[model samples]
Target: MTILICNSIIILITKTDPALQTPMYFFLRNFSFLEICYVTVTIPRMLVDLCTQKGNISFLSCAAQMCFVLMLGGVEFFLLTVMAYDCYVAIGNPLNYTIVMNQQVCVQMVAASWISVIPVVIGQTYQIFSLPFCGSNRINHFFCDIPPVLKLVCGEAFVNKIAVYIAVVFFVIIPFLLIIVSYGKIISNILKLTSARGRAKAFSTCSSHLTVVILFYGTASITYLEPKPNQYEGMGKLLSLFYTILIPTLNPIIYTLRNKDIIVALRKLLAKLLA
Candidate 1:
């Protein structure tokens, strides 16, 4: 609920404020919407289970949940990569920033980010669910994540494991590498600015995004990339909780608190409502 409300405020403020009608805030709006969807996929069900003390989910329902999770997660990686490129262009090539990242281009990139994941997620979900589940039905984790679901498979899951690894490389690692490259260029460009104030201002624009990137990629890398041993299963769940729940909650606070534009826009909005 906190995630939803906070992110909704971002979306509302961005849409209503003319000053925020730029490429950066446009991407930020989409990201906040994505965060809302991302949390909704897992947290609500988790909450209900906690309340009822009966964490029961049907096989098809679990498959659907996992599919949405994978899709949303993939979209987030792509969106973050797009955002990194946007930052690079704004800082590295300011003259062409508006021309390059026009409204149509931004919409296309966002649409591609969303659509590109469908086939990959569907194929992966189908492959995982097609396997026989003759073993214990209980999922060790809070959600129907790939790792925990794979554990319940009856037969050898070598192929499934390979597919998952490939997906992670293509969707997660590759995007992260692209973000790193974009930021590298951005940093180089920022340093070239002769004026200290110019450099500081440039850094300020990126600080919020950089913080979000670290919070997201840091927790995600630890959760997904690391070897999942039985001894670390408990640790794994805790890490999953961080990425899935904590990150979404923090994102709105990070952006709104760090961004002066958002702060001013929010204040104006509040004053207008009160008046």
Candidate 2:
């Protein structure tokens, strides 16, 4: 809750600024919003559990958690896809970049990513939530995730598992493939640049995004999609912490630090204030 509140306040200020309205900041705003919704879905219950240790989450609350965690997870996956596309266009097509990534198109890209997640997450959440928990109600993790919570149920959660698999295919595989494809073309375009300076600049613009992509996917795949058993109580917990807490916070910082235009704009704004 504290994290959510503090982030909300900061994001509110950032959003009201005219200058923080580019693709990077646009990504930052959406990422911040996702953080608010994401944390709210799980933390309050976890906080209650921490205080009381009894942890009696009602069925409805459990359903809500499942829905939101998957929802936000799906949303985050799609946002990364958009961010990758943004970088690809900015580096690969500088001349038509503004026209290609105009406000309307950017808005649509963000919207399409978000819109694509709803049906997929809703279907998966519904399958998992409606099942009978005729056995242990104790969720091992701090919050209700698909695997930890699924292990507690009595009957075969095969359908739920399948739904989860479908979501994995849609959320992880498809977007990941799209990212790879986009980067391939981006590299091809970068190679075609005649000047060494041009190639270096293109690579620098893409370097931060590729770094983030590798980190996020590396942790997520290892934690959630790995074949290993449930020993991830510690490692899984850490990885979960990364995607949940770390990514959103670090994204804005990555863009500001690495992107030259953003730094120049911010510096100009700061100089005006000092003057």
lDDT of 1 by residue, 199-229 (tens): 9999989889988888888877776676754
After superposition, which runs of candidate 1 have C-alpha atoms over 4 Å from their true positions?
none
Candidate 1, clashing residue pairs?
Answer: none
Q: Cα deviation in Å at residue 265, candidate 1?
A: 0.4
TM-score, candidate 2, is 0.84
Off by over 4 Å in 2: 1-21, 44-48, 51-54, 228-233, 264-275
The ten-residue window of minimal lDDT in model 1 covers 222-231
TM-scores, all candidates, are 0.98, 0.84
Candidate 2 backbone clash number = 0
Error of 1 at 130 (Å): 0.3
lDDT of 2 by residue, 13-52 (tens): 4576677666656776676687688877766776788899
